[model samples]
Target: MLQGNTKILLLSLLVFLLIHPSAYSQENSGTIEGTVQNSSGESLPGVHISIPDLELGTVTNANGQFRLTIASPGTYLLRISMVGFEEKTDSISVASGQTITLDIELSPLVFQSDELVVTASRRSQLIGKVSVSMNTISPEELTSRNITSLDQALEYVPGVQVHGNSVNIRGSSGFSYGVGSRVLLLVDGVPLMGPDDGGMDFDGLPLIQTRQIEILKSPGSALYGGGALGGVVNIITKDFSDEPENTVRLYGGGYEPVRFETWRAGWGGGSDFRPRGGIIFGRSHQVTDSFGYWFSGKIHNNSGYLQNSTRKGFETYAKFGWDISEVMNLSMYTGLRRNNNEQFLYWDGLDDVLSPGSINLTGNEASGANDGLSDRLTILPVFQHSINPNIQYTLKGRLFGVAFRPLKDNGHISPPKRHNKGLRYGLEAESTIQATDEMIISGGLSFDENVINSDVFVGEDSLTVRNQPEGALFLQSEYTWNDQLTTTAGVRYDAYQVHTRSTATQFSPKFSASYSINESLTARASFGRGFRVPSVAERFVNNNDFFPLESNITLKPETSTGYEAGVTYISPILDAFSLKAELTSFWNEYRRLVEPTFVNELAAFQFVNVTRARIRGAEASFSVSTLDQNHQIKLGYTYLNTTDRELNQPLLYRSKHLLNGSANSVITDWMEAGIDFRAASPPERVDTDFSLFVPDAEVFPTQYITDIRFKFQVPHVYEGLDVNASFLINNLFDYYYVERPAIFAPPRNFQIVIEALF
Candidate 1:
């Protein structure tokens, strides 16, 4: 009873369906049968297995097994892909009418990859030969840990710590109240900090698309310029997935009741549950043979563990790729984030730690100054062209903007509203050329401008403006002396001019060498000069009298001379186990160190260049993995010796000893588990007079924290769909701790995560 057009449509649909699946049954066809599993030894279900050249694919079944047939196959490419794990591809030779078997193991993203690192040198180089102490966090690890912000994950990195939103590497920073971060943070090679805060924003980054985080523990100003005095953290975004598909992730969690009734918030039960959850919806596909796009949107809500600490956020991220021609390509990445947060400055006296502390409110202000709305947008476009095999260059353009407006949640009285509207834009071009077989040259030129209009600035009455323009030229040369020895030398010159001020300039230089002593060992050493320009905030911030913070525009830049030596060894200790270990020692001498100082005359705090300081440290870390890479154990230790030359005392807020460890195992085909531990000795000193302003302000104690997590996976939950459920317990011992004076660290908490990939 169907019409002629309907019959035609049905026939076309039937033909299209038969073409992919039935063609493999014909003569001379080849068959591919395979098993897919994670490096942790759990078989993966719902994995997409495909031969892109032939436009044929199959999904793995309940047992992580798959089979596919190809007609008229000679040689083809085989690819397997899944979410939360790395994709794998292989080349296969097909003999007519023959069945080929494959066993594919995909590694999880949490394990660091040392094959290539760009942060250390501003160019791709092998981690082993980079001549720096470099660490990496794989994307899978972030996903597995269910971290909602960037700072939360930094806590697990060796020799690195977070003081509020500021990051300290190798004891290079202290509690300066979110100004002038020594460690530079970048997202896909673009600076991530704003002009007003000069501090990292934890919640605005797009994590779902991050591929890897590279931590270069050395003076990076020679290559990255200012803000790299301590080191660099680069978050590399990912390329589109190999297969076109959609993914969904859902996670939720909350804290357990406080162990002590005295510390309970006036909420549900003894303590508020502080519920939190988030959802991510993502899709990626190829629009044509030469163009593709990937994007995701995330919405997260959190009740927070303390009063006036709630936060809600929404973010969207997208990436597009275009293979314009055989000799050129383009990549475009964009991100937008909107966030509302109730900031908790410090806890009330230890007796009522779950309550927000007052900020010396004046007038009839009712202590509700902790609310704010923030928005951020970033766009980066990169173009590359290949002149020849030895000559290729890239051009990058970027725009980063931030807007923040303070809000009052309850009754309040203030002189003026506070707002920050900032923008940063830049253009850079770089090239890599092989001068000869043993020599390579890399160099770049950059021009950037920063502008901020805000009422929170020291000299600003209402919405005043400040801006700085900068230009830089950098060059690096790498020479391979022989099969076992290599050296790199680089230098950068920078010029900066405030719109209304005179120009200032600096030159940074660096030299490093790496020697492969043997197949299993490598030795490296580096020396560099680093510098940091004072941020607009450090030079002009005015916290509106709630806090005792003032600004001094005369603050000088901070500079350092750093030296490092390290050795890496890969031991063939056992036939069934692989061991990799590293030991490093470093020394840094800083001059004109910028720190916050209490001005007795003004009765406020100010950023001042007050001291010459030194930080010397030793770090050791090792990892052991089974032959099958199924189970892993990692351990690390760091020792720091620091002194303020002007005061003859240890640097404030610098932990002398730190230790961290982790163990992971696959218990069964459908189950896996991991445990992580971190410990630190209490800082030698904090604010000498903090107790006068806030009770127990110097209560930081030697601390220990542990986390445990387990995952259960269901493969083939439906056709081409896989599901994984995870549970996590943080602060397993329920220990009370603080990273900074008077700031309450998170208590014991639990989380559940569900992820589906199709």
Candidate 2:
């Protein structure tokens, strides 16, 4: 009925309407929804879900729920990842205007090589690619072993020795009465060593809040500065989790009597049974989409095994995080700890197990009460910003305070009550730049100020306060070639000013390389420089006793050069089992090594830089794990040869040969068992003249120790509650050995622990 022009117009309108409808439908996006959970059906938060090809990603919320919007209908590979868990990928298809729902379950990571550690280079990287020897202990491992202290957990590491409260790595440190520690101790990347002695109080750390512990077994002064002449131990605390957790642990144990007939003769026995108990409550929740908080508190009491050795302590921690924006975040952390303990001095003689030694020659076991109190507080705030995908920056500040008061029996003669207080404040700024796909650069600047107040060190009856300020700048770069070879180089410059002493500066440089020879083999090499400045106590301590100690302010800083080479091999799976092995050789040369030299003529001890030393060692380790990860075995051995070049004698307090072995098995769904064993050869030589009470012996005897643990998870006791009971037997063989002369090790002991989680 229309004309020719009208008819053409109508036909064009019809075609346009049909095509527009189809195009509009195609442009509509679809959504993918999913929930991430662990193998045990527990919801897992903070899981990353991504489609790599499409460059689209989202993170699961507290409830493990995630949703992604697709630009168009297509098929893509969906990937999910999280630490301590296996990665999962699946093919997902989406249609226009439709929603796809998925549920994923991830398993726990089994191999140590899969772990990502940060202490190696101050940045997160795969363990397999790290050029230095390192070790990691996870929360699961700590819980399974029923470990209650940080130092107790480190004893299993190869080339490490825990004598009393001191930590020795590769024989880098001898017994110095806690004056200096070559190894550095850090909590959440913040140094906690005492300002006076440069030693740390391992008992003050909140082990209940720890998530993991990483040990870098190589010189780290190029990045960490002083107190890292030997190595570094970094304790990483737990972050805020979406779910709340509460735990209570109760344990009771006892000690065995002295084994030797001579030692048993003087056993001034008390109640042999000791009891320990603690409770921890932690909770974290999302206040808003951009805000979250976590808090925990723990209290513990221990009726120690030895006479007059009792301890009680409590710790509290809190953390808060705010997401300022998509590219910025701010966080704050606070921690406090307080403890009181009765100290036990060394044995009076080898024949007496209960006769404690006295600092004064004319004093008896009960002449004075040796007791002390320790308190610590820490505060930290951090800000992080991402300028771009490849550039990031962080700013952090920390404040730490420690107060210690010791009451000795001979206060009248040597100042009975001495108070020591240390205050430390520091600020750090760091930046990381990913210049390219194969290269990265990082740098940091730090400033630290230490203030110490003490009466015993500066003078008796006079309170003195001193300050030491330090600054450092460090830079490091890592480059990868063809994804098979990687090299890292770093350097640090540090300057420090003592209150009334001289100013000093040090330059440390380190270089390391790793090469992947094959799919299962990797080789690594490293060379580094390390140095340590004298502690305030080392240069000012003045104690008047039978074994007097006089500080020397003319002491120089100690320095060392270290080199190491290692190879690792991961064998292919055979019959649902696999084996991993590593071998490393290391050499270290120290100049101006510090030690307390006894002046026999004056009957005094002086801290001096008097020795040039060389230490060479080799370590071998092997681990076996089943494909199902239900059974595992680990073995490690270390051989060390140390020489004091100036004295032409072997270094003191170091074992020439060491062996460690452990096995863990999940025998049933709810039952797990583990065994740990250690053996060490005696020191080749010791300085028996340092103590008259100790027997004069050129060589100490070898020692063997073993521990066994079993844990049973109770089922269906209560809804939404988990309960576990553990049994531990330490020093299983009842072997009697001395860690230090006249200081016998703890005999066989038993502990029963009952823990509940909700």
Candidate 3:
């Protein structure tokens, strides 16, 4: 009953299936099976096994088992790899119409120089092959150290400094309240910074769902867009597993009392002793053969050391994935968070070190109210399709919303009583083509729109809102001349419309080259251009203070160029020991740097592009580990020189020298201990022109701090249950120092954590 054309098509399809080499080979393919285990004879999931020549690979499931089908029977080399484990290679013979089974046992990796990273080039590649400087922190490392916040985790990275909520990388940024940020923060490749102020909210990130954190210590605007003028921090969340997994953690800690009793005077007569604690839960499950889901939640509370600084927050996250077919896939993520806290603008005077009071706090209102509350939600969806063996495309989109309320501000006479809300949506499409075995090209187009409504920022009588739109196009390529030489180049063009009126455009370009001197050594050099668009707050803020700040409609964007060269040596294991070292030097030049300038005649301040600056720095790090990976040591040092070229003076709030070190050892099968230490040569200058009540303070002095931690693990007492406990002592020596002008670092503190896994 079929038509003549339909019959002919069916016949041709039958003939193609019967005679095609691919179809015939698949019908007669052989099967390969394998299991992966660690040195302790425990199943290790997520191990990747591949036959490189055939361009085929598979990851082990929850049971550490994998199965592969080969199109033909022949001899091949099998390569197996996993992070924190030594790689393995083996020669095997495959017979037609036969099944081959093999088992592999891998040892712990002493030095993780070969770990794979994706943020460097937006593609998976060995860390050792990346041309830029970077650092990674794993979930295991976080657990061992009992780190609960992004800032705490980043402190361990070399050439990074955390001051309150701001991060400075290699002296690239000084303090700027909350207006602008040089370092960009990302969660699973999506920007997480607040669009209103271009500031990062470390607490908004779902730390409970993170598997790893990657820090790129170089400008990445060529690939990441704005707010990456200095560097980028990418937090990669965990993926779903084939089997069910659950984890729960609870931690409690307390801060030491103020050092000088006089500093706490005028505050409440009650004890200043404060307590903090948090609870985290995470779970993952495979719904079916091709579907998976992950969920995590966290609740935290802190009775801050300073008066009227208490805070409480909670966050929840979920992700779902579906493998629609062999060539297409889809994934979606959603998260919600809410936080409430008392605001502590600054100290009332030079002597009130531990007290919390703003400039407007009068003697009669010592215990007045100053509070802030925030709620946020985000949703992201992604789809991927493979058109052929060498071509693929991806589409991703995000929707984010934030509501912030300044409940009370005792500092201001008639505290605005403003409720600010912001909404943002973005979409991007990308394509990748493997032109040849040695060449790869990728291109992407992105569009974003943001809208904000506030009674304070915009005029109260004006019903119109502020909107900003952006668009970008980018292209990147990688080429390899041989096994020892490789090069990468990328460029991005971005256009932005501010206040639905003025338009601005920028072009960013990046270039890098790497050459392998030997199997264990590599040298690399890179150059890049970066820029940052002005934030909404910077252009339109009405605080109505003594030195009121006025909006600047003609403010220009901040731009910079940077260059870096580095050499890395990854030593091969020798007699159960290995060593890795890296040395890097970098220089950056900035033009049209945005900063607040005071117009003395007008008795007002305005944000303007009025300065040129330069920063040069060098960093060195060394890591050594034992064969069993039970003992390890790391050391790092950084030296920086910064100058305001136009002002002929040193930059403010930037340290000239820094040193950090850590050592860890497995004391027994169930116990581990570690020690961490850091020393910083204080800032060479301080900003005194701002009318923020900051005193005429001099340079900070050199200071050293140390911390010690011990962890104990208990094997499964019941089926599918394990427990771990940790004790940490921070600032072991109880050294007191000031990180910012009047902001003193906390004295010695202690924390305890308990974790259960199933």
Candidate 4:
């Protein structure tokens, strides 16, 4: 059995390296560089530096300084975590080649504490730090949760769930075969979906150029490999460290059927190419509408809002950095996007009552015109080797490429233009090993190449090619059975080779446990096993008659098994007001779940896997912050529950009782204001009934909605110029609902924004 499970995982990693030890030592180590400001001094990249009883850690770069290496001199104990700050400890005295310089000041853990604890495993001890089912969205809870995408900002992240815009972790079903390719989207750390449909179109993601939005639900396929089963939504972005800044944003809203507008502008700059590198660039744009149903049939309104149609897009991102000195560093990134579209399709009886609000006379001509373009290139070369300080090593590499243009139909039959191209190429080799002191190990390997030339699934001059070679091997062990229990187990083995099928192997098992119940609070539990394999439009496109791949060849490769229990709380006692909450509940059971079938029937759609379902959900989140010196206030809430175990029903367009709230105030010293609110639960429809020429085929309907926003900011003038403004209101009462009843969800709109910083 693989040598007794690799000798019981090397005798449980030699009993956790003979009881944890290795915080730093090479004669007292010698490196402790500084820089980490925020009491209004800027600079704060990555942030996590620790030495909690010698767990040894480092992460600051991007100008916030940080050069860890301890255990050489004498008296030592340092810790500084970040995630809305507040957790700093210092007491150092070392010598040998001495070089300790400090300048730390962090505060704002939501005005002292209601608990928003999130240092994502780099430690702050929130019950064994991190083992899975994660959620850490803080940029002041993402600008008071005005969220535009990251799947609507993770809809209040808990176990996380969002359907219409896609995002379903813990309760997998990620929208099924086509529109949702089972989770996996990262921004910093690359991979942003669309590599031949691992799915991700968060309305063309650009959430105001992000700054933080980590959500790891679970199953990262061992440090991200293959769509990551159904979790991982990284996103980070937003680094230009002082010296220059500019921003402009506009918004428009509607909800009485639908209507919209949007715009964005950006600018960036960098300096001191040494504090660990820096450089950035950005761009943005948007447009929208939904008067589908011809203004609701001359205003008698059917709410289909004239069948709604129209959408536009644009985006650009760039980054460059290099600092080969402090233990080696390098970075490069690029992204570009484009979109133009018009869509609408509806049918029924006579359709038009003389253009009673017309989608151009009800019925037949259902429109379609699309132009989507994407280009991404990335190069990441990282090397960190502090081999002398309690053993340290990190070598990373990544090369990426992507090009996709999915334009379906246009050319009425013969002479049509035809275009459908998709491509992907990737390479990765990662390593992180800390050997002793209770062990620290990380591993990786990846290679991918995928290509597709759709004709809407191959047909008009068809062209198809698929070559995939996938691999994964992972091992993790973190054990500290004393001071309050901590246990982590790992296992991973995934393999794939498909040119049509053949090589397939999966072995996933991960377990976690964290317990403290003291220093504020902590308790956690986790179990994992996730797998997926079925893409390329779900195994070779063959519609309009051209079936032979064994007609979807008895496909099978979609598994899930997840369980999570959570609890973590930190407090400094009311009055300073601080609270962080997390309540997770998940039960996933799926085996081969891909739907949409109808082969030879002219209006084709097929991607077997038949049926098998089970998705249970529970999510909860809360936040509260209040700081008096600068007058700050924050509030938040989120709750969700999903169920659909083969018709046990309740999982269509998601949205099941979601409420979000927010408020921010800084009053003077340049002014600041904010407010936000949200509500949802109405969207669940996807019935096909039996189509041959369209028999019952249903679409979507079920409605409830609300939205509101207001913001303003202005700080400093000459020296570090700053200015901002925003006002938005969408659906906020113009609500007639129906975002997918054959499409139509926009009504009651308004928006405005302006910004600048230097």
Q: Report the number of the highest-lDDT candidate.
A: 1
| True lDDT of residue 188, candidate 2 | 70
Q: 109, model 1: CA deviation in Å? A: 19
lDDT of 1 by residue, 326-394 (tens): 779999998899988878777678887777666453332224227778899989999988665345788
Off by over 4 Å in 1: 1-114, 265-270, 359-369, 410-417, 460-463
Supply every candidate's count of residue pairs whose N, Cα or C atoms clash at under 3 angstroms. 0, 2, 0, 38
Top-down TM-score ranking: 3, 2, 1, 4
- Candidate 4: 10-residue stretch with minimal lDDT: 291-300
Question: What are the Cα lDDT values of the candidates?
Answer: 0.79, 0.76, 0.78, 0.52
Q: Write the per-residue lDDT of candidate 4 for residues 1-758, one digit (tens) a residue.
A: 99999999989877665333322246545777787877755665446777877677765543455666665466678888764467888888767778778888777554333222222232122312564566667655554444544566675554455654457665465344243366777666555566455577564444546666677776665555556676777666554442234444433333232222110011011110101111122332211121100000000011122322334445455555455555554545554545443334322212220011212211332222223434444444445554333334444454445554544446132222234456665655545444432344545555666666555454222545455566677665655544455676767787876445377778887777777666556778888777777766566555332222112534567776777787766564455765556666666666666665555553344567655666665666666555453443333333445555666766544555555555566666445555545555554435442222332224443444455555666666566666666666655676544333233344555545444544
lDDT of 1 at 219: 84
- Which sections of candidate 2 miss by over 4 Å? 1-112, 260-267, 284-287, 359-369, 408-417, 459-463, 545-547, 693-699
Backbone-clash count (model 1): 0
C-alpha RMSD values across all candidates: 13.6, 10.4, 6.6, 23.2
TM for every model, in the order presented, reads: 0.83, 0.84, 0.85, 0.31
**Cα lDDT over the full model 3:** 0.78
Which candidate has the top score in TM-score? 3
- Comparing 2 with 3 on lDDT, the higher-scoring candidate is 3
